[model samples]
Target: MVTLELKGLHRVRSKGRVYWYAWRGGPRVLGEPGTPEFVASYNQAIDSVTTPDNSRFRSLVALYKASPDYKKLAHSTRRNWGPWLDRIADHFGELRIAQFDRPERIRPIIRQWRAKYAEKPRTADYGMQVLSRVLSYAVDPLGKIASNPCEGIKQIYNHSDNDRSEIIWTDGDIAHLKKTCSVEIAHAIDLAAHTGLRAGDLLRLSWSHVGEDAIVIPTGKSGRRREAIIPLYQELRDVLARIPKRSPVILTHSKKGPWAPGSLTKAFDTAKEEAWSKGDNLHFHDLRGTAATKFYLAGLTAREIAEIMAWEENTVERIIRRYVGRGAAIKEKIRRLNEVRSRT
Candidate 1:
């Protein structure tokens, strides 16, 4: 039951049962540790010449994946991290984990691996993040190493104002994209713009979640750590009413079934390509900020927007500053200034 407490132990779950190994691809231990059979199998596996010469990374990856920590990741986070975990195994599978104890020895290896994606700084940073997590798990719960070589490794990607990340969808952009996308996807875009929900949360939104005066649900990004109660403003309600409630899940695919993340993304990309010959490269996520701006203009304070969007007040402030045009901001400021002058 507690076999994981031992070093090099790997666990696999299938059909509601767990099987134990001395190390992944090393030797299959028959039963729980401390049993005579388990002890014998484990000792034999550790000592056997037939046991393949192995890098512990694969086994470590297996152990980490089996943990509750990995299981609890946001659906999107797990989806993104999965491919990187596979890549980590493929790239670093040959290295013995004991080498990590000497930070000087392993730092160059991580750096060299990271160097391959220098042109794509974000991708490089993400890969290192997954790799570093695996190594850290190996150090603590697995007891395989004393330290993570990835500790203090600097990330190359830095946020900047000039980045395309600041670009938001204009009304014209929305109209063009809606014209190109399927009715369902267009409806999804409208919902995202109104409620500022992530694509995953948007797809999962349903009739039961719609209350008399609000759309209430936990967000996918926070993994249910927070709930967003979006007031049923006429604008958001109007967008919701445009889509029919045929499925328990909103945002169906190909006129039926739930919209999976991949299918939805593919449809969105196709729409973007068809919508513009050379358009602004904005993501669906940018619509969140668009919604934030909408809320700010409608007299919702930053704290209110933060609560409804399940975002930080600081983030709400940034979005209000970023997405609201300069002229609009100045005009709004003047309007507020006049209101105070009238009061005085």
Candidate 2:
């Protein structure tokens, strides 16, 4: 006989003939295992719309919560999927693992979401992918569900035929921005352009990460500790020299703590306003793209760029194609032109 108790929720025990259940809300049942009566009653109680305290489901939930991987997963997942998770949770009204274990229920939810996102089909599809992943945790050894129902659902993404252009800072744009922005923001921008660190990584950058002619980030996005050597160019060093030791952040603002989210955008907006130019549609991320482009143009292979950027070689290619499109793409275009010239 096995007994299960969820703190502040409910209790259940297996006896010789049947399973006994008790809960705070209001429910009691006893039925022999493998009987229709037992399964029906269990399912009904677990599916309660108001304050459900089903012990069977809680067992699985507890295991997932207790996992050592949970904290690291939460941090990384929130960083990437926080916005989407909030939206899904709002629509589902705090769904439990058992509720989402069936393919029929998941299919309807996905269809409903697709209808809701008819205008932006791509984002709607991405929401479904996020939900699928959350539900997949139920299949772990300690979980209640035997399998993930979301395994078979096909995804549809809406992408445009034309590639999105990246904002490339020309020498003149760099000069103007450097002169216009405060020394702190200007240095941050320079570092961003040269190092290709993501905006989040750049905000977390500290003197501790800097070493002899190198920047070593022990925890990169790919879950690897990668060290990239930065040439101690006079221009980069000059930018680094202007920081105020009083500020903990590399990019000093009046407020305490690191650069605020969208800090670069605010500075860019000011620079655009001052220069009487429509600001580049590029984000702070475009700086990473710009750096990768320069690296590629310098005849570095994708593998070499991956090492510097702490990305997989394929990821390096994707970034180059999406952001720079300056290497083989340019050569291919020129080749097509030459072919036309020969034909003429």
Candidate 3:
């Protein structure tokens, strides 16, 4: 493609390739200048920036986007909220904010919109969360409403409330999975069970993160505020030694690269379906509780494990109380009885 001069048309050369933009720091424009496509691109860019407000809701949304509060958000947060924000805009952009001035009216409307995503509880919950936040912004700094209708609405997703008895991925479970699942899935389970890292964080893990004494990396969750310093426990180290250094990431799929989010879920689900259409089960996240159990059995205190896993101290305590002591409790009673008999 050849370049031509046009007002506000920015030309950028990257990696020996030419790219055109409607303006500096603007959307990419395809086709050559003076062509119909280029002209349409420029018009679209201008229209996007100057689009008229459909309603006060949309106007407040625009204001929220430009606010310092939004600017201060973490990159991961903005990325997660991006789609939900767009969905909210598409669905409610034209609705008058003043029309539903009371909680009774707004709450029902919010629930109705949220119900559409009920099949995916987490996704639906996130959409409601983003929508609520935008409306909350309207109530506070914008003062467009007297109260936030989003407050006190219960979230539908509740993974935290899952029963702990059947949650841990034990040694037997791991061995069984290894026999049937792909190599990457096996390693992923091992990594999660040992380190208690979330799936996204573990997929992004590389050999470089393996420090001289520990695997040192910032967690993807916690807004990346917390660092996970997993010690090179012999078991974890052994798991690492088994994998060939085909790529920087310790776990990789068929292509020998990091797994994309969608691909990781697909691969995990396929592995599960191969092993577990007929019996009791484990999800990838259950490995976090498994790791916590290992840490407890290995003598780490609840507070210490909590810090390492980025969980609340009480949450760690709850998991340990539920999963770590039942058999041991009975065994200790037997030992006490045997000691009394020997003494007598």
Relative to the true structure, candidate 2 reaches a TM of 0.63
Give the local distance difference test score of model 3.
0.79
TM-score of each: 0.69, 0.63, 0.65
- Between candidates 2 and 3, the one scoring higher on TM-score is 3
Q: Compare the candidates by TM-score and give the number of the best one.
A: 1
| Residue pairs with clashing backbones, model 2 | none
Q: What does the lDDT come to for candidate 2? A: 0.63
Q: Relative to the true structure, how large is the alpha-carbon lDDT of every model?
A: 0.80, 0.63, 0.79
lDDT of 1 at 185: 82
Please write out the lDDT profile of model 3 over residues 186-258, one tens digit for every residue.
8888888889888878888999999878888877676566788888989999989977799988888878877
Q: Show the lowest summed lDDT stretch of 10 residues, model 2.
A: 1-10
lDDT of 1 by residue, 114-134 (tens): 999999998999999998898
Worst window of 10 by summed lDDT in candidate 3? 323-332
How many pairs of residues collide in model 3?
0
Q: Provide the lDDT at 325 for model 2.
A: 50
Q: Rank the candidates by TM-score, best first.
A: 1, 3, 2
Runs off by more than 4 Å, candidate 1: 1-43, 46-63, 86-106, 134-152, 158-162, 178-182, 253-257, 312-342
